[model samples]
Target: MMVAVDSTEKSCLSADGEDFFYFGYGSNLLRERLQIMNPSAVLVSVGCLKGYKLAFGLFKGQENHWGGGVATIFPSPEDDVWGIIWHLKAADRQSLDEQESVKHGIYSPIEVKVEQEDAGEVMCLTYQMNCFNYSLTSPLYKEVMCTGAKQNGLPAEYIKKLNAIRTNNYNEITPFTMQVRDILQHLQINTSE
Candidate 1:
């Protein structure tokens, strides 16, 4: 049901100096987080990936609190994954690849057709869980996803779905959780979301 919004620069340079796009549905929904990692990244639009459902799972062998499940897409004809489209300089590919842990094989980038609110359909790369995780999300991690969704103005129904995701119940703040706090602070996003 997404319709078009006003357009912005829609260019993303890949590793081979070719422009491409990235669809972010997880923590990357926080523009600040992606900006911090890839300065050239720009918001293309809020969009949805059809035929897929969002799920969280752990990356096999990753240790500690981060070992908790991260966001991923699973094929489901009845589902549409809401997310943001990002355009980046082709040269920024390596940095994004590293930041995304693509080097570690924890996630794999796959091409998908994301329907922008106002822009129709466009093919963009989105990461999917390639390794197994604990299948649980931490409280702080859930906060990150919910806050990002609210900050970006994603649909209220979808935001509620994000909020309803059950967590592992650990709420103690840790150095790792601080990363979410930092992004929230940087973007001035309300945790109340």
Candidate 2:
């Protein structure tokens, strides 16, 4: 899906014009998770999307690879969702879209205005779920988001809210979760350096 850009929104393209900004509110907020498929992704800034709230739901009532619901954003008049702004090569767009399951009709790309402290309002590409049947996310999935939020220095109140989210209590270690765990471990180690 093509997102229309408004003239007033700040451009966030890289110098070569071969990169674009993406606002990641869900699993993509985790650097390791995003880097797995889109290696060109680089942290740009932390921002908040006003007038939207974070949500989790099953896609077509089916659990995702994470073994439970996945994260998405929905319109909320008084809320704001805090997340990371990533600068990525234009070549990674297809892989990023696939990671969000856009081709499966699970998500649809949308253009949003993110309020950044340093950059002001910038137009970015983000995704929202097509289905909103509320569901619980897996414990590991929630952990990934919380870790990313903390690691990236999102607001304390927002991190507290993320920590308060209830999980599906999926304790069994799936192969995917195991890989994610390893990535998180490595990320933790690297961040400490």
TM-score of each model, paired residue for residue? 0.84, 0.89
Across residues 22-111, which tens digit of lDDT does each residue of candidate 1 receive? 889988887777777788877778898889989888777465454367788889999998988887767778888877788878778777
Encode model 2's per-residue lDDT on 80-141: one tens digit a residue.
99999887888888888889888899998888889875657778889999966889999888
Return the top candidate by TM-score: 2
Q: Cα deviation of 64 in candidate 2 (Å)? A: 1.2
| Candidate 1's TM-score | 0.84
| Model 1: lDDT to the true structure | 0.76
- The lDDT of each candidate is 0.76, 0.84
